[model samples]
Target: MQKQTGFASILLILLIGLALTTLVIGMVTSVRSLQDSSLTTHAQTQAQIKSAIGYQALTGLLKPLTATQIAQINNGVIKDNGSPAATIATYKVVTTTEGCPASTGGKNYFCYDITAKSGGASSVVRAIYTDITTGGGSFNGSIFAGGLQIGHTRNLQGDQTIQVGAAPGGENGVVKGNGSSTFYDDQAQFTLATGITVQEYTPTKFMTAEELRASANYIFYANGKCAKNNLYGASIYNTETEPVTCSSISGITVSGSGASKKWTIDAASSAIPVGVLWFEGEVDINLNSSRDLVNTIIATGDMKVITTNQSGAGKAYAPYHYYLEASTNAATKKTRICGSSSTGIPTQYCDTAGTLKALDTELAKIANILFLSNKNITFDVKSNSPMSLYGNIIGSGGAGGTGASSGKFTGNGTIDIKGNLSFTGEGLTVTNGTVNVKLNRGDSSGNVTPSKKVMTLSGLRYM
Candidate 1:
């Protein structure tokens, strides 16, 4: 009986020992599971934080960057960078013609499918990007001239003071208004802002003539390269859907040869022509357009802005030179170059910013139409001509195309301008009309206020 009792006790002890061992094993397994859960939670939080960082980084890096460059970064064409390998963000880019709600057509918006990691955890976010150009470069003054000639004030409020630069021969230049109003080389009567350089006024400073020549939706070679007016090749911006003139006469009318070649261009009545109107020879440009999409003109020769018919024509004329913005001489046509007519800050025309625009007018002129010339310019109109030029003009040499008259303005008209002028020409020869130049620094690109873009997007926020 005693032996049986001893055996039962031993059996009970063995059972208890087995139970304790199982409980300990179960508890250890539970603890390990909890530890893993905590580790995963930490990793996931880190990944989310990293993803947010990438989202915000886009604001600074979006502009001055093109979709091509972004793709390069995504396709590993660009080197990956990060302190720790796991901390870097990885992304894929997907472009769509109709992706964002604002995108009516075209690749208007881009999205980033981003993946960021921490330990074994990964996070993803999809971000759409758009920009607005509220601020960028600004106009230095109403008029910038290599020389100034003023007989009398035509417009009461127009730019009273003209910015002057030295002509080629170290001539102090001349302003004919305040003093004798003479065209001969004389002292400047206005405050000489000589610190303002003439190099800044060159349209080529913004883009070269060759670069513009390549981007033109339509081109005329006074050099007689191709047929005058309406280029024959496929347009870069798909803008050559129609011609400017309805009659047999092409848009460009040429009369002379060499530097004196006279090129006159008519306006597009059917559709607002897109891309640059690049002319190889000097021209009398008629500038005015409703749509702000593509309206810029560039000339290799001299420029003359025809404000009205030399005969008494009642209608207003813009210019024969470059049309950087949608600003028209006729106030009735106020569609800005980068925005709608007096709408909120320009959004639709806000652009994909990049240095690649010298050849891409589709995006280059979306902000400002660098309406400039490498040669001299003439704002041609009678003093009483019912006209007003609401845009800015810049050019190179004098009334002479870098020749004997290169150092002076011998053009037969008043130096009257409604906007600003910056040139390296000798001076104006305003012998007949009143100086109507009022410092009317109107909003750039035709907007009531400047709307540059593609501007900073108000919707760009961290998710």
Candidate 2:
């Protein structure tokens, strides 16, 4: 019996030993699996972090780069100091013309391929960016010129900003002039509240004088008459004396009385389909103040305005305002031009094609009269004639072309302007009576908004 009991004890000990061995193997397997998983998770985290760093570096360098410079960048590596690995992240820029949509006008888009590696593990990320213009050609300032001058009592309010190029025979590109007979900023008669902000002058790339003349929808010559008897009431003086004789004649609708005339021009119904009107030579305007609404007028020579004496409170309307490409000459006496009691005219009357829908909808469009010349812009404000201009005025030189002599802006008598006055000319001189100048916000683009260059990111991927 003792021997049998000893045998049973031995068997029990062996079984317990086997069970202990199995438990040890299972624990070892679990530990190995856990360690492998932890290593993989750590590598992935490092890779992700590195990838983020690379992406940041790429985006940081792209904002200020011009389109030409961006196109030249390829296979470029940008490093970040805060990277987790010993080596900084690597980046490659690939430009492709195939991917960009047709709407971008054949402009090339950019592809950024980024790679980051740590501990033999790597992560790759890709992003695509589309090129665009932020605000088109930079206007730089509200007024741009080679030289500037201002007259007495000339209130230049509402973001009175100006940019001047190098003057003729002046050092650097600094502007020179001011005051009654001078064109220097220091000698100007107006007081500088925040002071006149000056910037280096750059030629206007927004639109050129030659381009304006070439794109003129209506071309008028000297002694052209804007007769009220015909439909659309304007005729170019040619061989034909009829009101509708001109090939590009258009009509204007006018309303109101005295200094309160409202004008509307229809783009669709007019013989000249476009909004631009070009005057080739000196033209005279003899509108029976009762029937005329003017749009954009681009003059190549000189412009003169005269109203008939049969006045029963003459009314006029001009929505987008006028653009005088050359010089201007108007009646020195008080004559009612145009005015509006309403905030703005309806879009149906202003723009028929709806191309200027934003102008119609937002009412952000400013009614401005811009005189771009290399000569002089004269505004006659005589006594007993309260000449009041309801829009902004921009008198600039070099409207004829580059290297042209800067023009002059002169005003006389009781001249009342409800908007800003900006001049990039030889000087501005206002004499005789009180030259009342107020400020109003108007559209700078007339009524047309042209497309500009811009850059934006689109497709993104990871590898």
The C-alpha lDDT values of all candidates are: 0.45, 0.43
Q: Best candidate, TM-score-wise?
A: 1
lDDT of 1 by residue, 1-463 (tens): 6657688789999999999999999999999999999999999998887777766665456666754554455421112365544335665664564243354432345566666788999887677765423321344453334444345433223323444544334345543344352433422322332211222223212334554454444556655544223232333133323433322335556787766777776543324333345677777765333212234566777776554434332232222112332345423233222223222222223222211123132334322333455566555554334334434455655553234222222223233333444454444323234434334444443221122345234333333
Candidate 1 residues lying further than 4 Å off, grouped into runs, are 1-136, 143-145, 152-162, 167-208, 223-249, 256-261, 267-275, 286-295, 307-362, 366-371, 399-418, 425-435, 444-463
Q: lDDT tens digits, residues 114-175, model 2? A: 88877667888887877765221313234445454334334333344555555444435244
Q: Tell me model 1's lDDT, rounded to 2 decimals.
A: 0.45
What ranges in model 2 sit over 4 Å off?
1-93, 96-141, 151-159, 165-202, 213-217, 221-244, 247-275, 283-293, 303-318, 321-356, 359-376, 386-405, 414-463
Q: RMSD to native for every prediction?
A: 14.6, 17.8
Model 2 has a clash total of 22
Best by lDDT: 1
